[model samples]
Target: MSVDEEQQPSVIEELTDVHFKFEVKEVLLELTRQADQENTLLALSVSQLGAEGKMRTYDLTITSYLRKVGLDYCEIRDSNNQPLHLISSSDKHGSDLLKVEYTKADINGPNFQTTFDNTEQNLKVELSSLDFLLHTKALLSTINYLNTAVPQELTASKDREAKKQVEKAGQGKTVSKGPTNSNVFTFKLSAELGSFRVEVCDDRRNIADITIQGIDGSVLVQAKETMVFARLRDIVVLDVDPKTIHKKAVSMVGEEVFSFQMSLYPNATEGEGYSDTSKVDGKVTMRLGCIQIVYLHKFLMSLLTFLDNFQTAKEALTVATAHAAEKAASSVRDFAQKSFRLSMDVKLKAPLIVVPQSSTSHNAFVVDLGLITVGNSFSLMSAEGFSLPVVLDTMDVKLTQLKLSRTTLKQGSPQTDIEILQPINLEFLVKRNLASSWYNKIPGVEVQGMLKSMNMALGQEDFGVLMKTLRENIGEGSKEHVLDVNKQVARDKAEQHQLEGNEVGCLPVEAGGGGGGGQPAAVTNAGGLGENIVNMLLNLEIKEVVVKLKKSRSDQKESPFLVLHVAQLGIHTNVRQYDMVATTYIKKISMKCLEFSGRWL
Candidate 1:
């Protein structure tokens, strides 16, 4: 619920191959990068549309990840999601546009490219542009969406690439390598709007973001489980054979029972993404469908159970890392079989949120979160030997159906000029931030201390039994439990939360949109992160992502929806710049970005 974020993309303004200039107000830079999430930058600029005429145009730049904005015809637009006028049809990607670039002076090397001194009027360089690139017409169309904006809202740019990536991301996993050549097409979508009663014209296409916020670690747990599944999927490509999968249910935390089944198409036909036999477009693909149980704590333990030397820290660490990883690999290899599509009788939400209609009797306390069944394809065709990089994709799992239930939460802001290092709506990265802090204080025993602390102050003594009773009352319950727990936890969170978990996630950056997508009404602040702790920079590269669009610096008060794809984004500010800087970034996190999103090169 930030005051600055007004993501109203009704129209896009185009600046053709103009000599783009930028000036980063230290205040805007300081406030946004420090106050808002990372990946968001606000700038003041003037670009040229024609080389023949010295026509300098001004722009209020608000962007994240995206480097340059090109208008199709070099025209600008008005607040109404309509174009004021078209600039020139001669506009195109190369000469008519996309000429401005910036080159970062490497810490130890000279920036032979365009170096940004960051003056009010800076020089445009062919050296570097932005991590993302956007155009006018599509952008304007996206911006025009603002006229129809809603209260507490966010939206994704409808760029073709962005649209395709989102469309392709139908709940599946992609093979992630270091940093693929992909662009961020979305931006953070959280907003505080004066209008909304928001209704999607196309429920199938305009699916709402998913929010996960229950007292149970559904958000956190599911995140870890997905990672485990991704890893196993990676291992499967090596074995080159799919097997029949069916595992018995195992109880978790004495409440929910977890089980799994995964089946791949073209059964033992090896080299799907490798040999010509499976080639679809000079590439092979192994279509897979998987269903795994999602018992928050137990499924976690099962993964740990795989390790050779396994020990669970009853305090901070909930699952065994070494042991679970091993077992998970085995499970995935076994589950990666040929042809078996998962069929469900439940109604499907575009990106469905399902909860197991049935559970073990012992699961008296069902958390209602099942393993997120994302049936996407993974690329196994590579020259490297098992270079494990997992991508998030959307697909149909041909095996078992997973269950999950929840709503979405929103957050975001616009920009200022600063070198970007992308960070967006990652609710789970809170664990990384907390982990970073723990590593800072006590590298060895930090995890244990953190777990104990986060749970300690939130619930009342009887809340446990109350939850137990409530679970029994509606064990296989409605979505109310998740919502109630999230709200109650947010309300009960100690006004000042102790920093002990992992410090993960980036700035609340560039243009996409994330109005308060289903964020509970009662919640006012990012859970766990209090006011004092509000900003961060990891000085690290993100290896995986899921966004697919780029946007321009528009007058929209809000930042563009931050895309989950791209290697780096946002203004690069050192984390240690100030403790508060790191804290501010951490404070804007929400729970929706973890399970279902991203892009590929």
Candidate 2:
């Protein structure tokens, strides 16, 4: 028979209650055999109804072996077996049997309470020992069968005989049997619970292939293999704690856990309506044995190990990324420093020189002489002419002297005896002149009458003569005389001195067709021989020289130029190589050139 061809059992259509009674007799001799015996009461009640429609009830009674206490009443003991109270009850029906009222007992050591429910319709009893209660119920059920009313006992025996006859009739008969064929049983295991259908195959060899479905005919357990057959005992145990199965389903399938909920109707037809019925919230537990349980443990362990490895790999990647970022930033900083270093080399290569000129009609000067490079531009100091006094404020030897030379000059008359002073040693002057030749052009202009007048004021010494000459010619009137000469003199005199004292100084004697004579022939009739000599000296190319007159810490003079300044002697280029060099340093570096138009006196 295939599964579909098998007829399913019909559900019970109604409920029936059958009253039950039992007679129990204890052997008196067995009670007397124990020493230290006392009257003992055994408390029990009905606990369950069996599948075969049997009812069980328990009678609690007390018996005494001693004649002193007799059997007048039953003594009740607590759950701990200690006597607590005496109990008795009357039967109004005039029977000798005692009625047992439901009561309670407390066990102090284990802290538990035992109670009994004694309603006449349905009796229930609880005891400290669940095993004792179960045994008592089983005994009562057995006795109830033995002591059933004669008519009911006869009916029960006839039913048993009919079942045996049916089995006998089926024996030796050919019943179609195969894996595909099945016999199904439909029943409610308990009131208010969902219905169940168990399908069994007809072939004995394939008997282990069973399936249990819910009320809606959805399959719950399909036993297609021997392992499921061995799980029969676990399946039966799982029925008690169905929530365990729900939890497992939730863990495995998450939100789909509810899809496996047991239905309330077995074999429910499509579109069929159900009548009003009591419903219960139930669960189903799938009890897997040791093998499946071990498998779940290993699966969880492997999952945890995989997570650990993933975390370690992620941490390593993070560290590598951080290191790469640091290295890149460091490289950028180094490259920037290198680029700045390359740019600095170009900026330091160019040098600058500044020449500031100051002039008046009688004299022109290069004042505030300064030579500057990129390193020392800020140290330039301002002064009045090349010979202006420079105070020695610092002790460093390198800054001992401010180097200076004449830029432009105007010679005074022979009578004026004016002279320009040298401001440094003659040795250093030679070095400067060697470096440049621009100083060779400064002209010497002389008015012989002016020089003779200056000589009359002096006592004829060189220093006195030079001072007297400068005193007369560098005065304010002398400057006016030099500039206003063309404004009053004849055009011939002005033209004769045109190149001599106007914009350019007097022309050189060689250019003027004079032999090595010291004086110019143009001034021969204006002054005496001494006057002519002074005039010639004035016309000599005299470059203004600077003496950086520093006072030496020792007694020795600080510079050779100090003596020339003290003597008021005009520095001549031929007297010292340094004078010539200093003249060149000034001409090349100064904005104004020194022009010489005659020989020295």
Candidate 3:
């Protein structure tokens, strides 16, 4: 029934009903009344029409059960004080035998009642359990309907759409912060990795370039445009088959441009790579970022291992070619094998590594390994007959302006040719010690054992120790730690200066004309080392030759054995070839050294 809003009542009557059907053999039991005009007594009878069942059996059973609990009969009424009359239907296909009608208001009314014989409390509990079961079944059915009725693609699309909106909003918020003087891109991706700030350049809404620098503003990687994703994809290919051909093109929209499996530490919560693109408020926006703490740590550890490997590889190569070396010197019948032992240690101490402006070469990349100090010792020993052991110890060998580059080869199997893009600014040692003595005085076996021990000391354990020390001194990510590191650096510099001021050997050499002074002059031209080398070669000015020899034996301030020291060496050359400039350098050579003392065996 429906009613108009104006006709609706503040409180409306609700209907509640209870129906019970009792089977008496093939017939149903229903409530009936006697035919007496003055009598108000109720009776039970078979409900099925044309049914013939004895009334005595059902009457006795029901009577005994009702009498046992004193719940005589069931009666129901409406809000009014009148009993609901029981009406029998002619067609009882789906009709209940005993049905009572009542209003919700009459549940507690004096005229309304429902009676259950012998097990009323149990029936009430069963009704509540049935209701709960029905509710649960309905809820499960609804969930199943949703799963089956809605397509998976549609659901996934909806989720992607929602995520896209969120990402776009975030992108807009970050990009709108404005640009600085050095960076003009308004859509820059700024992120912090430990104490380093990673700035990603935006190219037409794509992450095209990246620059990493310390918090102190020292650039680790220059802000040069590059195929960032392409390079990463190439690196990823190294894990698979390097010869496998893949799509070189990339895009910022739609599916991911590139993806690589990230190696994670055990029990890592997050590190899986991700990329996203979206459009919000009629403008397209995009984002690409990675959180790779574990991978970064692994890479740094690998770098340390690489440095250690350099020394090990040299020693291994020398040992591997020992037979060839002996064969080359087979003239003398008693000629024995010569062994070369080398020890090298390379460390990165607060280095400012930089990837300078992109190379103009067709297919090449440049990396400037700023200033590196290589501490090494070289020893050459011969066994048995002709025995002269030559040992050279180099102190603080500094290689500066060392730019390493790679150019992709165009022929044969895919390979990148490594090259030094710039001339290495090699500084001659301020101190050198060389010693060559008779090796026959020492046992050959003992000398070999010493070299073997040196090789063993350069194992992974030593590398691990070095890395641990570096990590300890690297400082934390916080500003406070950076401040503390800066203070420590200042203190170390002050101490170094104090010591240098007192030491006579550390004193600066005078810049004398014609023959240069003791100390090698610092490259002070603003145009850089390459420019200076080019200018010197073009001008052809021969001043002095500085010869720095490695030290051997003990590192005491003074040693008996001395190496050749060149005070001056002048070369004269004239241009003879018109086509070949470098080929026209055949000239007279004049050399001079202050001291030379060594045994000529």
Candidate 4:
């Protein structure tokens, strides 16, 4: 009856308490308490949170850890000995957040305080180690995201490097700078191989390299991504000695080493650090002694190899079948002034090589292209007649003194092309039809007389009979009368000077009336040695020969074409006596023609 009578008001305070313990340095235990009179909790511990906290499996209660920090019974007193309290409530913060205040007191109540919100930083934790066997079985998905990115920074850096190259070696010429966009490379970290690989491929290039080792380790440090990125110098210090590593590359909670894995946007680095693996930049020189192109072709896959120096490689390329067909009709004033139309299709062969001529010189090379001609044609038109179409079905060409230079192919565009420098020498094996117009260009009289003489010399035609036909065509009676007068004049001159510079293989024959001393007299069928050895040129077929063909001195401007620049080698052949029989035959003919003068007349 008294207990019920004692509860007079509904506002009876209930007892509330909290406690904590800390086995910290020099401190056995600490605690935080909560009083039944006040709604606020108090720290009663003496140990610091970070200094005393260990990564150990212990109690999970909030009050257990809170007591270790020792926040209860901590207070400030004023001059009047008045106690002060930090007054804060969870309701002051919005939902999903908790705010707490630590206040200090002046002569007034609680004056200075600092507040903390627990929801400001968000951290994510994922554990894939729980299923390590699944990862080994290739059943885990490690790909976090797929992204396509343009590496702007990489492109700018590459362009700057290219510009420097242009200025360094260029002589008033702008080299073709190709597109700087590097091929897209996908990166993968495979738990199966325990390695990471970067893969890149395209029409121009391909690269698949393995890298990033020693990465499987325990984490020693973790920080907010915002703080790490924004204030990077605070976390990492460059120019540090290897000895004083603690000065900071990474500040870990323990002494274990940490491997850093950065996931950045694609536009960060210079997409790929390889322009050419052999030589990247600067001036380079190259030399080769007795090098063969066929070997280089097999080694380089495609055939073309660019060298920065004698040993430093630039680029290796394959032959592209793409051809450029050109049709040109122009007056070739160099030789016989012919108007010609040339339809040529230019094609490249794999493994074009330029070898130096001597040990001292480096500018020249032996250009070996194996073969190029397949369907090229040439046609010439002149005042004398028109030539039949000449087709280049198959041919091989070797050249010397070849040079290389850079030129802009598509001006104002991104790339450039390589062009051969001028004055190249060519050795050729060309097969084509001998146009009848070529022989027809000879004067009709000269052609008729030469054919008749050649036939007589070969014993195929009668020399006496040929001379009789020619005399009839030219009116022999009048010719003989003029010859008598010329013979008399020659006789008078023979008396004045000695016969030192007489006609080759012939003495001046005294005519009955006049003499025709300058011209070669007609041959007669006298059955002599000269008749058996005529036309020796038709007896031999020359397989190899060298002919120097040059343009007329009057042509000031030159063209990069076979027609205008065929200098050291050509299709023309020179008849040379290789056999003893041919040599003997020639000597007999020369001696017989001089001995028997009246027979030639």
Top candidate by lDDT? 3
lDDT of 3 by residue, 234-283 (tens): 11101111221211111122222223121111111111210111111111
lDDT of 1 at 380: 28
TM per candidate: 0.16, 0.13, 0.14, 0.13
Which of candidates 2 and 4 is the stronger one according to lDDT?
4
Candidate 2: Cα lDDT at 217: 17
Every candidate's CA RMSD: 31.4, 60.8, 40.5, 42.3
lDDT string for model 1 (180-292, tens) is: 21221111111111111111111012211111111111100111011011111110101101120111222123222222222222222324442322222111122222322
Off by over 4 Å in 1: 1-21, 26-279, 282-601
User: Which lDDT tens digits does candidate 2 get at residues 285-376?
Assistant: 23221211111221222234323323433544454454334333333321111000000001111111111121122222222212211110
Better of 3 and 4 by lDDT: 3
Model 3: runs farther than 4 Å from truth?
1-185, 195-563, 567-601
> Candidate 2, 410: how far from true, in Å?
99
The weakest ten consecutive residues by lDDT in model 4 span: 319-328
Q: Candidate 4, residues 1-601: lDDT per residue as tens digits?
A: 6876676422222211333344333233322223355332222323322112112121111211111211222233324663221121122222211111221112111211212111211222211111011110011101100001224455347545754654443233343332232221111112111222222211122211212222232111111111011101111112122221111111222222222232222112112321122222211111111222211111122112111111111111110011000001011111221112222233323234432221122222223333332223332233343332221122233334333322222335764323333333344434332222233232111000000011001111222322433344234334534544466467548744533554321211121111342122211212223212111122222222222112223456322211111111212122322332322112112111323353321
